[model samples]
Target: MAFSPLLDELVESLRCLPGVGQKTAQRMAFHLLERGRSGGTRLSQALSNAMDGVRRCDNCQNFADSEICGICVKPERRNGTLCVVESPSDLLAIEQAGDYRGGYFVLMGHLSPIDGIGPEEIGIERLLSRVKSEGVSELILATNPTVEGEATAHYIADRLADREILITRLAHGIPVGGELGYVDGFTLTHAFRGRKPLTD
Candidate 1:
């Protein structure tokens, strides 16, 4: 027997999620039908609410409901130290550490020239502007240790070469080609503490 259009649509929508295949989507649909009726309703509501209400902080690009995120607006975090990350997820990982008492600037993605993603797409210009306007004394590049992450860091460093701000990259303890989002909070904190300057 053929499935109804609504069921098919739910399955298709589930597949749009990361790592969800046809089988997984079908499983999810069945689970929703069984033990997840209320969950399904809540999921839909949460998705709609977040999509409509959540916006990027104009300065840091982190999720915000207003013009600036709470972290960016708080006066205590204004220590002239900024941590640059590849994405909001990476920023969250750093936040989980609770050791670094600085603000963040999320890149949202790394430089992928082959895929046509560049500085403009990642708002590098806006980042430069923030660095200059925010009176940032130190810039901690917390991008992942991956090739693309390194390339992105180098690109930013090159642009800010003449600036007096101290530029440093996350420590190599993160492992080569590893992502900041996947690293444990303790490890990330250690990495941040051990960060070194990005020399020529």
Candidate 2:
């Protein structure tokens, strides 16, 4: 029995998502098919809409419909504190915690020379400019607890030494080598509350 070209293409395309394998993609495709056209159409619409409208926020690099994300544009969040994160999802996690009331600088990724990702690739220069221009009073390095995240935080801290801003990192509650996006809201809030300054 041969799978139809449509199903094969669907499975292949779906497999492109992170952590999704061929079996999962096939199951999802079948589920959508079984659920009928409404489900499929809704899924397709959601995918297309998100892909088409989602763009990096000009201020914080978070996903946004406009040039700046809601967080960046918020009047209350215009304070001089900036939370630096590796991804938009991490930013969302922190937002969900409802602990941070300042702005953010989304790195988009960490420094990975072996994988060809570098400071510029992760928008470090842009972040530096934002730090300076935005009158940032403090920089909170909210990257994950991985080696790459540590390296990135260290690099940014070193580079920003000339600036007269306080630099802090999330507290130890996030767990070693754990990703910020997966951490629960309560833990994330606790981490933010108990954040420690990153000293030399």
Candidate 3:
């Protein structure tokens, strides 16, 4: 049986979400129409507000509502030690682990020359400027254990070769092909503590 035009539209729209297939989208549409009209309205409003207000941090490139992020403004964070992450989700996962007190620099994405993403695309120059002017003495590469992540780390390390600072990579407890957002807090904590220095 075919759905009404509006119902079909809703189902198709819901499929935009990841992992949401036809059946799931149909079910979601029904639920929103039947028992979640108010909730659906609120969710749409929230999505709109976030799209309008959210932007990247000028300093670290992390998602922020204001020009500077809270982490950058907080004075208690360790300014000399910087943790670099691929995305804000990775940064969130590390923060949830709760032992890291150093500042962070989010890449938002890694180096993918095939896909045309280069150093300027991910704002590596902005990061280097921060290191030179912000007194960052140590940088921790907390990118995922993927090929792109490894390449990005090496590229950043090479760029900073002229700068006088120590560099480290997260420990190996994290399995290959793993993303920081999917790792549990305990594993992330262990990895953070056992981080190894990258001299080359």
Candidate 4:
């Protein structure tokens, strides 16, 4: 069996999403065409609007409809601390965690030599400039715990070593509720290295 050309194209377009495979795309296309045409129209309109209007914030490199993101514009967020993350998703996760109240610099990606991404590609210079100009006292390297993420953090730290700011990396370890027996060796090592004393 074959779908009409337009329907097939819709299914193919949906397949471009991260986890939507052929069957999932087909199901979605059928659902939209069968009983969700209005919802699909709204979705299409929203996607078009976002694609056309959204751009990276000048200050943090996060997606924004204006020059700067909402987080960057908040006066209280400028608390002499800057958290560097690899993507907008990472920033959103931290925001959702509800503990951090400082500004952020989204790298958009980590340093990957094979992918040809370098310091300039990830806006390290802009990050450094922001640190210096904003009088940031604590620079938090909140990048992912991958090898490339570690390298990127180290690179940024080395670049800022001459400055007076205090730099720190996010601790990588087992989750609060995780069982030690189920934890991997790498995570165990990190947990041990980052362990803190419970008593003075």
Candidate 5:
């Protein structure tokens, strides 16, 4: 027998998540109904609250509940060095790495002409203004190593070429434990392009 309208709607809604197919959504709907109705209700409320409360930070463009994110407000963070990333998730990853204590400016997205995303949409002007006004002297580009990422990095570099600020990109290569045989052609090319000389 077919599910009721509510159950069918639940399954269909669940399929909106990435990688969630019809069967998986149906299973999720059944699990939520049978074993975790209260948890499901709590999840729904939490989602609603988060959707309503979350806002992009004014300083760094990261997701936060307030005008600025915690990292941007922290006095301990390096202010003169700004790390530019493609998304808040990338900023989180860098934070998780526990090495970068500098400030961040999230592009939120790359410049994709075909996709209709442009420089203004990604807040490039805001970032440039911040660099000019906030005593920022360096920009570390932490964009992903992809075609769009490269284009975005290049665009920013060209724009800031006349400025006195220094600009650098994240190193792209195979992981520490990854072998050359397993590394792909694009990664190998990057590794070669960014090769460093060994200390004698």
Candidate 6:
């Protein structure tokens, strides 16, 4: 059965979301039209507002509705330590962990030469400028453990080698409850390299 032109257009638009294929999009469209029109209207309004109002935070490059994000304006968060992450989602994850209390720099992406992403493309110059101006005492490279993430971290560390800031990379290894036999060799190697001396 063929859908009306407007319904077909709605289904096609729904497919723009990640992981939403034709069938899923059609299901969603049908659900919205049949039983969730109010909810769909709210979603549409919210999406339109966000699309028009949201922009990158001036300080951290994270998504924000204002010039600087709320985190960047907090007085207690200016602790001279900056955590660098690959995206706003990573920042949110660290925030949810409830241990870190410092500023952040969202790279928005990792270096991918094949994809034409470089230091400049990922706002490295802005990050360097922020580091110099912010009097950052510690710079934590919290990028992911992937090859591109590692390369991005190394590149940033090398750029800041002459600075007095204490540069550190987040440790990667097996999970707290993970069995050694189930862990991959790369993770085991990292765990061994990052081993700490047992305290008495």
User: Local distance difference test, per candidate?
Assistant: 0.91, 0.89, 0.90, 0.95, 0.91, 0.95
Local accuracy of candidate 2 as per-residue lDDT tens digits, 51-112: 99999998778889999888888888978888999998898899898988999889999999
Task: Please list the residue runs of candidate 2 whose C-alpha ends up more than 4 Å from where it truly belongs after superposition.
Answer: 1-3, 173-200
Clashes of each: 0, 0, 0, 0, 0, 0
RMSD of each: 6.4, 6.5, 6.4, 1.3, 1.7, 1.4
Measured on C-alpha atoms, candidate 4 has an lDDT of 0.95
Better by TM-score, candidate 5 or 1 = 5
Q: State residue 36's C-alpha deviation in candidate 5, in Å.
A: 1.3
Look at candidate 6 and tell me the lDDT of residue 135.
Answer: 96
Stretches of candidate 6 exceeding 4 Å from the true structure: 1-3
Specify the highest-TM-score model's number: 4
Where is the poorest 10-residue window by lDDT in model 1? 169-178
Compared with the true structure, the alpha-carbon lDDT of candidate 3 equals 0.90
Predict model 2's lDDT versus the native.
Answer: 0.89
Judged by lDDT relative to the true structure, which candidate is superior, 1 or 6? Answer: 6
lDDT of 4 by residue, 1-200 (tens): 27499998998899889999999999999999999999999999999999999999999999999999999999999999999999998999999999999999999999998999999999999999999999999999999988999999999999999999999998889998999999999999999998899994
Tell me the tens digit of each residue's lDDT in model 6 across 67-127: 9998998988889999999999999999999999999999999999999999998999999
* TM-score per model over all chains: 0.82, 0.81, 0.84, 0.95, 0.93, 0.95
* TM value for model 4: 0.95
Clashing pairs in 2: none
Better of 1 and 2 by lDDT: 1
Q: What TM-score would you give candidate 6 relative to the actual structure? A: 0.95
What is the TM-score ranking, best to worst? 4, 6, 5, 3, 1, 2
lDDT of 1 by residue, 1-200 (tens): 17588989999999989999999999999999898999999999999999999999998999999999999999889899999999898888889978999889999999999999999999999999989998999999989978999899999999999999899986655867999989988778878987889982
